[model samples]
Target: MALFRWGHSWDAFHDLEREVDRLLQSVNLSLSFQGLRFGRQYPPVNLYELPTEYLITAELPGVKSEELELTIANGVLSMTGRHISPEGAAEERFRRQERPRGVWQRSISLPDRVKSDNLSAEFVNGILKIHLPKADEVKPRQIPVAFGT
Candidate 1:
């Protein structure tokens, strides 16, 4: 009944890990980050499909129209932007930085080909809207059946 006991080394290791996490969280640092890709999907977006087009909307606070990049190729739409800290404010002065403060990029695939020439986008009040018009071949067409004359 007592031949084997719980491992003390494993428990000690976990305790040390918890302490390290606490210290890191207090300072708000990325202990495993290797650049700006901090494992979070920034600028969360929503996709909607309509009868004539597809719409994509995203909330991009602190990002201006000139600061964002949008591109579509090979049935995929990509968005990139950066959020900068306030002017004259140092990083050390930030008590908490939950929002990303660097460049972030995200991409999504389209269901079908879209009319690139007819595409439109608008940015107003920190909101981004992109309209992807459906291509001619992809649009649903109504066919009338011939009736007896």
Candidate 2:
């Protein structure tokens, strides 16, 4: 009888170990999937700046010009937009989706004083362009210096 009892206890321990192993495997799989999703969600953006103006361009294929909103406040420029997926496209079937969709916002600090009222934005093809003109005081000017001997 003692031998039979030991055999039953051993089976119970083995079953418990298998359950724990399965739970651990599921957790690891979930973490891996999350990491992959995050990597494909956010891509890099390019910004350009000149001596008198600031220019920003973003790749937004299939996004309409009217969908984007640009604003400047307190020396910061913010760009917000949404990219609608193509019609009849199945989102779940995509093998790789690097382009970000939904409402996205990017804010950058102005390199110089900018005339927010005169800012302009245009979208052509797949590029979204922004033009920010510098304020009068921030523009470079030549000043004559006199030396008194």
Candidate 3:
């Protein structure tokens, strides 16, 4: 008379699947997953070593020049900035927000000492370029040898 009989094992498997789905939804892969949440690598940068200077370029989309701060100390170059949310963004709920927001910082260690006072920075088209002139002692120089003194 009975067509089929489902066992308790089927119910257990369904429960396990539901739990896995819930766990996945609760985790924000971009921020945290393991024991701790990792900091984001905002405004990824590239460093170029030249004969006389060092060039550092960073992509800072959605961030303004006024919101940025640059400093160098102890052979380290520090960059601090804030990315403000768009106007009226608070009114809507974001299902998935990935862009960096709020105050963030990044630092890069210089291979050699740089003239901080003479350094310059420029921001254009959402890209930041920094020019750090190498110190006198760090710059490679050629020595001339005299055949007869």
Go through the candidates in order and give each one's C-alpha lDDT. 0.75, 0.67, 0.76
Best by lDDT: 3
- Which residue pairs in candidate 2 collide? none
Summed over model 1, clashes come to 0
lDDT of 1 by residue, 6-80 (tens): 256567666665565556556665532422223336666778899999998887866888888888888998988
Task: Please list the residue runs of candidate 3 whose C-alpha ends up more than 4 Å from where it truly belongs after superposition.
Answer: 1-40, 91-96, 143-149
**Arranged by TM-score, best first:** 3, 1, 2
TM-score: the better of candidates 2 and 3: 3
lDDT of 3 by residue, 1-149 (tens): 11122356578576665565456546644554332234436667878988889999998876777899999999898999998888776736776666667888889998889998889998889889999998998766799988996
Task: For candidate 2, write residues 26-71 as lDDT tens digits.
Answer: 5554333322232232223456887767887777777787887778
**Superposed model 2: Cα runs more than 4 Å off:** 1-43, 90-98, 144-149
